[model samples]
Target: MQDILIVDGYNVIGAWTELKKLQKNDFELARDFLINKLSEYQAVTGWRVILIFDAYLISGKETKTKKSKIEVIYTKKSEKADQKIEGLIKKLQNVKTRIHVATSDMAEQWAVFSQGALRKPSRELIEEIGQIEKEIKRSTANTHRSSSMTKIQLDDATREKLEQMRRGF
Candidate 1:
């Protein structure tokens, strides 16, 4: 079965306290942070994720997407991100596919639910992501060490060269 995670980009930024502060000063930074976190999550988990942003205010009305195996959408001038996500649910929803929408907006949650998709509040998503991050950190803790530190393993060639040099010295 296909699993999809549809996120309201701005709504999440507004909901997450850290991102909320970033959003006030630099909206792009908030968006980037969300994408970076989600990108890591996607790499760790095998869910198809799409983040929708409202670019309705931009006069040129651009629709750009990024492929970290995740989609980033900037909605058209005539439509809202919520509308786009609802439409996406209609297109992707099926008995075999599960769609999960993430947003703190109550009306939007109900809207996606009507289309047979589960809704996740931003706070809940944030908490979940935090847990996942901790897990990743714990798992990767010993994977890398400072370059100047002790060598856990050395190449055979380097070991042989060092042995020869030591004998000559």
Candidate 2:
């Protein structure tokens, strides 16, 4: 079974210095940036990523949507992100699923840990993301280098035939 990663959206944004600054200027951009980065992480890790945002400022029902193949959820006005994450952990917990919640809130971390779900502090999660990004970069560089280093040697006859095909036929 695939592991699940539950991210506290606002909590992470507030905890990350760059994201916090970006949020001050344009809140939507910060949210979008977080979503995009998480989507990339999800693609690389092959884990089920669910990002939960609190709707404390807006009056509406909770909403769930998929953006870039990642699940994004906004809690109802009465519900907070932590509550939504906790509830999801409970529901998704099973022998086949390993649930991990990412949040900087101490109380929330303790609660999740007590519930048998692993907790990742905001900083640690951010570092893990950085590592993933670095690994992707390294692998891409290696691929380019290896492809350039290794050449497919074609004999004169084969090369002439391929060139003739390209010309016509």
Candidate 3:
């Protein structure tokens, strides 16, 4: 089954320490950071990510989706981001599709859950992101583990050179 993630953008920014601090200084920075973070999460997890942010006086217009390999929506001026998320949950959910919603808002979590969408708190999402980063680092490391794991032996001449260096010989 294909996995889909519907993220509450402002909610996540408010929940994540780094994002919250960035938001305090620059709204654009926070917005960009959220997009980049979601992009990374999508790349690592192979999930379809859709991010929603609220707008005022949304004209009951069709959602404007930014396709940067992920869907980003600025709620059509009148709708709250949460409302848009609920609409999306209704539209995207099916028996074969696994939908996960990320937000710290309890009401939103319950609402999405009632729609058969699973909920993940922002902190737990961050921890999972950290684990993904660590996995990526370990997998990309240049260190030679193959030889050590097999207990391969070093030649006597190489060992002697190491011993001479240790004794200043």
Candidate 4:
């Protein structure tokens, strides 16, 4: 079965420490950070990620775009992120897909749970992200180690001696 993850953007940003701190200085930065994290999560988990942001107060039409291979949606004016999420839960429901909604909102959790989608609280998602980061670090370290082992590290004197030997000196 294919997995789909729906993220409540503001709720997650408000829940995560780093994102919250970034939001204090620049909201856009926080949003971009969250999107990049989600993109990474999607890449690692092989899940389809949909990140939804509320634009009710900004007075903009609904917008959908792809960032870093993840789908990002901004709610239309007067539309709440919860409402958009609920609608998506309804539309994306199917036997072949298992949907997971990530947010800290208790009410939204209940709503999505009733729709047969699993609820992952913000902190839980953060923990998973941390684990993913650790795995990535471990993988990178292994790759670096393997690549480094392949290179010959001879000092200049040793290299010169080898060259002389090869030339039948």
By TM-score, the best candidate is: 4
| Runs with alpha carbons beyond 4 Å of true place in candidate 4 | 152-169
Candidate 1 residue pairs that clash: none
Q: Report the number of clashing residue pairs per model.
A: 0, 0, 5, 0
Per-residue alpha-carbon lDDT of model 2 for 71-159, expressed as tens digits?
Answer: 99999999989899889988999999999899999999999999989998988888888888899999999999999989989999999
Q: How would you encode candidate 3's per-residue C-alpha lDDT over 1-169 as one tens digit per residue?
A: 9999988988989988898999989988898888877787899989999988886644666466665577988887767889999999999888889999999999999999999999999888878877887877786663456545777478999989989999999
- lDDT of model 3 at position 67: 52
The best candidate by lDDT is 4
Q: Which consecutive 10 residues in model 4 have the weakest lDDT in total?
A: 53-62
Per-residue alpha-carbon lDDT of model 4 for 17-136, expressed as tens digits?
989998999999999998888888998999999999999568868999999999999999889999999999899989899999999999999999998999999999989988998999
Judge candidate 2 at residue 143 and give its lDDT.
Answer: 100
Off by over 4 Å in 2: 151-169
What's the TM for model 4?
A: 0.89
CA shift of 65, model 3, Å:
3.7
State model 3's lDDT.
0.86
Provide the overall lDDT of each model, using Cα atoms, as 2-decimal numbers.
0.88, 0.93, 0.86, 0.94
Preferred candidate (lDDT higher): 1 or 3: 1
The model with the greater TM-score, 3 or 4, is 4
TM-scores for every candidate against the unseen true structure: 0.82, 0.88, 0.78, 0.89
